[model samples]
Target: MAKKKFIVSALAGILVLGGIGVAAPRHAAAEPVSGGEITYGTQTDPVNWNPHQNNQANAFLYLRNIFDTLLEKTENGDFVPSLAESYSVSDDGTVYTFRLRDGVTFHDGEKLDAAAVKLNLDKANETPYSIYAFPNYDSATVVDDRTVEVRLKKPDASFLDSIAYIGWGIISPKSLTEHLNDLPSGGQNLAGTGPFRISSYQKGAQVVLESFDDYNWAPETKAHQGKAYLDKVTYRFLAEPSSRVGALPAQVDVIEGISALDVSKFKDRDGFVYLSNDANGDTFKLSLNAFLSPLDDVRVRQALRDGFDLDALVKSLYRGEIRRAWSHTSPVSPFYDKSLEGAWGNNVENANKLLDEAGWTERDSEGFRVKDGKRLSVRVLYPTQLDREQRSTLLQGISQQLKQNIGLEFIVDLTPSSTYLKEVASGAVHIYPSTWLHSDVRKSLNGLSNGGALATDNKADPSIQPLKDLAAEALATSDNAQRIKIFHELQRKAVIDDVTYIPLLVQAYQIAASNKVNGLGFINQIGSPEGVYDVWVAK
Candidate 1:
């Protein structure tokens, strides 16, 4: 592989500048010293380590250490060179050509080339189960030993941002062929050209990683290159928040999911540092299953939205730690429509009027709204992984409010993470609670559109076709301003008019790390850790 330089086009500049979210990195005041180990405490363990196989956001926390994305995104949303030293896009904005950097080899000793990049794209296209799968992808061809060409079925401005994500990371073709079936179990089945390699994986317990000594490729935006400073990194699964917080600086060098209520524990504490940043992603929301009974009526959906006070509920639960979200994307997103603020909220009178207009005026013996002898009840499909205390409290409040304000009975159906997806896709539940981990608003909108991951049975429903069309248009538009305008229209259609999704809270990363761990960085868009490549232990 040989490195080649090329001038980026106007579309390329728009794509790079389109990344709006910025991340806050933690830098230690002391000088960096190498040769140490750092242990991290995380809430959930990834079931799969395969970059193309797994779509879990938690998986990226570790998978990023084992694989490298072709292009790296910066804190300010600029896509820089990494595995691909330089890239250029076609004038039509459908073809992308990447020039591979020379002297890079996977941990398994396989050399990286144009064919390897093509294979990864082909694998991604075939695997529809992954969120990173390119629905618009047509084909990938190897131009030369160091050049690869990717062709999309349509023009997609978000394509570069999508590839820069961890899910699109390049894995060794040999490893993918050998452990294709067992890649989900992880363990020793993974190999990549990242700063570190997975030495071992203990299911339900921990994952151990050792620095890749031969690694020299890093994004131009990264301050550190070559080998990672730390010799070893260990990630221990601590499902319980108390257990994770208990470990602290004594047992683990770093811990994630620290509650805002417990921020005092690490702030200004000896040998500990509290790190917090607003995540640049989709907000936690409830997707109303439009295919279901009464929900099929737009009036009923608007009534449900008007029944609850999301602002007060989020404030009460998060205690100002998290901000109330009115739209799908975070408020920090450059494309977020600020006009949506205060557009929809608690209105018992309006809720009653809407429900009455929908012919749900009669109340049953249990005081639940009844239409044509059927009670108005919503079955909420909740995932077990998100069954935290705060979420539980939020649901309780919603249930109480809907019951009192709108006469709608809220039935919670707690489902395990494994079966949750299947259950939600079955459309048996009236409401599905989830969030998208994408930094791009176009990707988030696509997931909510017809035939998307969150669309489920709503694919055939005509109501969401408008949203789907808007999402497609946004993806095709190369100009940032035009894309932003399209997003604004899409938001009004989905949140205000259709009321398909009810926004709740914007999630932020609350991490507590030992002062000894220095140079902690995050993925520019989602605020996820960008591995320990730059992190060094202070002497």
Candidate 2:
């Protein structure tokens, strides 16, 4: 269930992890010790445990530590062997062969084998909510106990990049039938081959992971190739910034995505380390439901895009901490189109003219545009947990600006993650805001074009078929140059020609860790924090 971001809320909750938050006795620094425990404060709990069925960034961020994919992507965008010791693709690119690592075992003690690989791939294809769909994926065959072959219906150049996603994370085959629905609760059913195992899960409160003592297989790129140094990692769900930062070196050893205001507190602090990275993924943007009245018209959509002053709104909300985005892809990505930067801006007069031309010239007593006795109003659907930063304030400002500038009413609808998914699927929302995860350009197009995950859940109009075809062409070819060209045209059609989305701002990941916490690194090129594999307390 790929979902949207959050809305405004008050900060009133705090977590109490027993025996955590107590400072250990300090000593002189020496070699990295192997047995220690640390508590991590993160934002959201996993909504679903089935990797293929959930696309929430927070869920994958945590699961990356619990599961191992066939291959691991390096920080420099190179692939290295993880579960699969080696892999090769055929010349035509329709077939792939993987040699599973020897002596590897899932947490449940099931030996890693070719049969497990085939079972995972086949199950992903059968799941409806799987975000990474290999339309060309045909079938998988077990060549031997440690060898497997995957045949595709057609050539897909992006297959390797797509398979590296944690959503394809291999699990014990028996759990598929035994504990399919309850994986979210995470006990013995949450079986993965990674360095950590779920010791316990406390729903929305916390999840405790203990190091797998027998784990030794690590990606070739990593220097450490043994069990996780930390004995235990307790992830406390702290959605509020005040509670997370307040825990600090006392209650939590690491806190994720601290507010920009909290960065100043760590700069001069002696025992803290603050790390920041320019995230590589989808920009925070809004998708308009074309099935709805007024929004179905291109003129109305264009008016909405140019109606608000995004530059001013971003400055006021982020306060120079984050950058404004003008395209669908992040500026950090090679596929980003610099030409779209100045192609559009805040043009109040032009927005008004466009709305007038769309037959919304009449104004009601509330100053909202009216046509056929109906006022022009849109409801923006957003989740509730994302208020950790200033996201709520940012959205409210945009709504107010639209009302003042174009005589259009923008209503902010804040709901829980469960309700948000249902509203998005019902095709009843007028506007949906989201920021998704994508390491490849084709994945970005999946959310922008018709029938994409981020696109409105409605029947695709015949006119948008060409846009969808461009997305398919980008994925079918492996040539980097040809793929780049296709992505440019696809973005132009979606943003400039069709007015499908309003590009917002680039996402920045900020994390703070105690000086005692060592060997902290990101999981992928997109830079989500790796689970406590190599991290150790320096004492």
Candidate 3:
């Protein structure tokens, strides 16, 4: 199968704002023999097939198949047209006008027009689910049957970034109006203009998707775009890592959540195709709760930031599978600041000086720092999973190092995901490891210190206001050059100066498919697999 490249052109996108018509997408006709099924295995079941209400990684595995975003994000981070033929932004950047493509239909046989776009956006904005990260979008107004005008409160240059976001994909206006703010259950209400529609879904079991015969609108980033080649695609929820890896070449055509050992085992092998992409949403970091006693002091937080050998942490946890990373965004993000590397990187001697200067001078018999009858110890709450042993091993090394250098005691408390939120909300646990997955890095950076963890996280700190102001200015401006500057400066100030959060490494999402599968692809900024839409088995 050849690569599918059916997106609207950038030059045409520019010309579109000036009232020039954009060219049609180049579709690749599939071979006459199109009837086949793609059965794949994933780690988790879709929380809900609805994207607006869900934010899990595996959820997209289902949502993406049933829905299509207005634009398609490429591997290189460019946004091209999908549901929308071409869209143009107002000069002030507050208004976004989209020209709908002709002949596109949703799963329910409803035509995707300006009304559909308005309905989906309006519904998504009102969903009570807390994880939804669409920008502060105001409204979507229908200019004409084929055109829609979306207005934002302010200029968000990253607005185009989330256009291809999961759940932000346009839905059928009729289905939404019928449901009217009440979420339909068990994926029953799922409707989109994607190439496939939900055939059958049993919660926590299997989801079957059949290709939409009338489906034709696909962003140019895909390969062979008339409709998905496979007649049906079955996504089986295989939770165990061993089961996921074992079924790879035979039982399942594609599998994810493969263990690190299996990734190496199949990397050079001929029968398996391993695909790894960096996730943009979150970073693996020890969030220093600024409200915590010792961490409340900026000097102490800076000391801890300087003390930890982050490269060691990365090596221990990921075992060389991923690299040490900096910044709130992935390296591939447009606003990513590459210069932030090693600028706030780990150190040992500087850490001791800061701690000593902060008046934690007394050392106890156990060689741990003591001040005012308090031990220099911190508790870190983390989820107990496959990496618990690895994290324990790394913490042991850190314990030895911190004890010897700064006389600090580091305690790691493993918790389950069920109780994880309870512990975090309790505010008793200040330090913990968590990932923040998102599409736009601008949103990521601004809210990085505002919520969750902070070393000395005072949102109203006059000391940190300049950095926050710079970020606020960065978000308002649509200029990439200015964004790059502001993002870099924000990284330097927050991580290095404020010691807010230490970005250990960029998270890697692994997808392994059997040799039989072809044209498995990815979308969104984080690079998760788009769907089995373009995949076909060689029969």
Candidate 4:
């Protein structure tokens, strides 16, 4: 899932109406009341709403309003307490103790306690679909009625950062006891102890969230206290980007994601402003399944890596707004290394030499290299959409370059998003474009390099082991300075040696909003429209 940027402009003073000090009314006849409606659109409908499932980040963003986590990342990149009032970690970092806040209740009116926290963490560990099911989490113990202790298998410095993930959202123990099975698989019974409560949810259409009147344990980091300013927030699903952009100018108050191509359309619109930021997300990349035949050869893989011009591709496809990446860690991220830029660009001579050394000495009638009676060919699968079309064109150009320079054959397969994930996971597709939304290198590499069922087999390439080890060491150590050093080394290795996933470009998130909308801010890491919480309609 791509992180949506939060864009907010400063306001001078609060609006007044009818001799009362209230925020300015955005629409006519509507007083600046606390209970009103705000409509927004999303490009894709989430597959599941269960925060435990690692399906999509956008779902978790919507879930964030409903669910509470132990910690949350503030705009300034600091981790503050959300549910827990204070926390202490062991010197060795194996144990984490949290003191739960008092006077908090879930939507169902259940008291939030340490036992409830244990239940939530236990459920996340036992659920098969959970992204945090690794052996790292040893156990969760209730130290007291309001205190919980978490034990880890190793001293992970990023453990608190991991807890900040949406997958670790706190749930009511009562809700879990009643709907254990439904809870993990994403049923309608969504409940949490956040600022808002889910009034109603339609599977693929929309979700209605109403403020929790009794809620008071909001994090100190949040600007609004007690009940949310808006009475109800309606998340309407609109998959078409153009349609999403169209709704914002008329009836919709705020829309989440605005692509680079759509940014120009809202530059001078009445009462509107554009909020953009260099996203902590990267463009989709071509993931080569190294286990597949022909690609399994190191020489062939290196040739493929050396044959493409990433800079030119980004310039042509993205209108030069994006920065070309040389490593999996995005440029805006903390782990980014500027010295590794363009580590793998077009080198036609090196590509041909690598192919020749790999025993592809003979060219077939179609000008494709062949060995052992098999042609050097593979299909590059991509999703069928306008944004995907741009990616496909880049792939097609790289394929042509490979064929002309090193006598390799390639084909393109365009499919729907659903079919694409299924095909890629099943190993049916040889090469495909995929993306990762990770602010920290540990989280980014864990999604791709962790040696588990979810680990990409591309790591089997010996050249990738050092990079994987660096990520592992970073995850195991508790020292922040040491972890940073290891992650930087991992970034260099990913670009200079591994060459596993081709880093393409860092995409800029574009948001065009009406001028009436104030307090719109940009959050580069997590891309959800809910960042609109700070935004309000101008009086």
> Which window of 10 residues has the lowest lDDT sum in candidate 1?
1-10
Error of model 4, residue 248, in angstroms: 2.7
Top lDDT prediction, candidate number: 1
Per-residue lDDT over 1-539 for candidate 3, one digit per residue giving the tens place of the 0 to 100 score: 12122345542221111111111111122343467887889877755556776666656767787888887665545568887888777666677788879898878878888888887877777746424555668999999998888888986656666676775767777667775344435454667888888888877678888998987777776776788888998888887778878887688788766656567867767777777766666565667677668777878878876777778766766776677778655665555667777677467788888898999999899999889988998887776542321445565666666777678888877776558767777667768766655566555666553533543335566655666677667667545566667767766665777666767667666778776667665554565665777777766
Ranking by TM-score: 1, 2, 3, 4
Each model's lDDT comes to 0.78, 0.75, 0.68, 0.63
Q: Candidate 2: worst 10 consecutive residues by lDDT?
A: 10-19
Candidate 4 segments exceeding 4 Å error: 1-33, 183-188, 281-283, 361-367, 381-407, 415-429, 447-468, 478-481, 522-529
Question: What would the per-residue lDDT of candidate 1 be over residues 19-138, giving only the tens digit for each residue?
Answer: 564666676776778789999998788856777777666667788888898887767666778899888777666778898999999998999999989988888778554556777789
Q: RMSD in angstroms, all models?
A: 2.7, 9.1, 6.0, 8.4
RMSD of 1: 2.7
Task: Pick the winner on TM-score between candidates 2 and 3.
Answer: 2
Pick by TM-score: which candidate is best?
1
Over the stretch 1-539, how does candidate 2's per-residue lDDT look in tens digits? 22111111101111000001111112224577889899999888877776777676666657877889987665555566889887776656677788888999999898889999998888777747466667778999999999998888987655666567787888888777688777756776889898888898888899899999889998865547899888999999988888899998889999887777778887557898777666677888887777676788888888888999999988876777788888877777767778898888698899999998999989999899999999998888888865446777778898899999999898988888768877888777888887876575556766666733434545476766777787777766555666667777767766777777788878777778898887765555465555668788986
lDDT at residue 411 of model 3 (Cα atoms): 83
Q: Model 4 TM-score?
A: 0.84
Q: Estimate each model's TM-score.
A: 0.94, 0.91, 0.84, 0.84
lDDT of 1 at 80: 73
When 1 and 3 are scored with lDDT, the better candidate is 1
Q: Over all chains combined, what TM-score does candidate 3 have?
A: 0.84
Q: Model 4, range 64-90, lDDT digits (tens) per residue?
A: 678878876655455567788777666
Clash statistics: count for each candidate: 0, 2, 11, 16
Q: Model 1 lDDT vs. the true structure?
A: 0.78
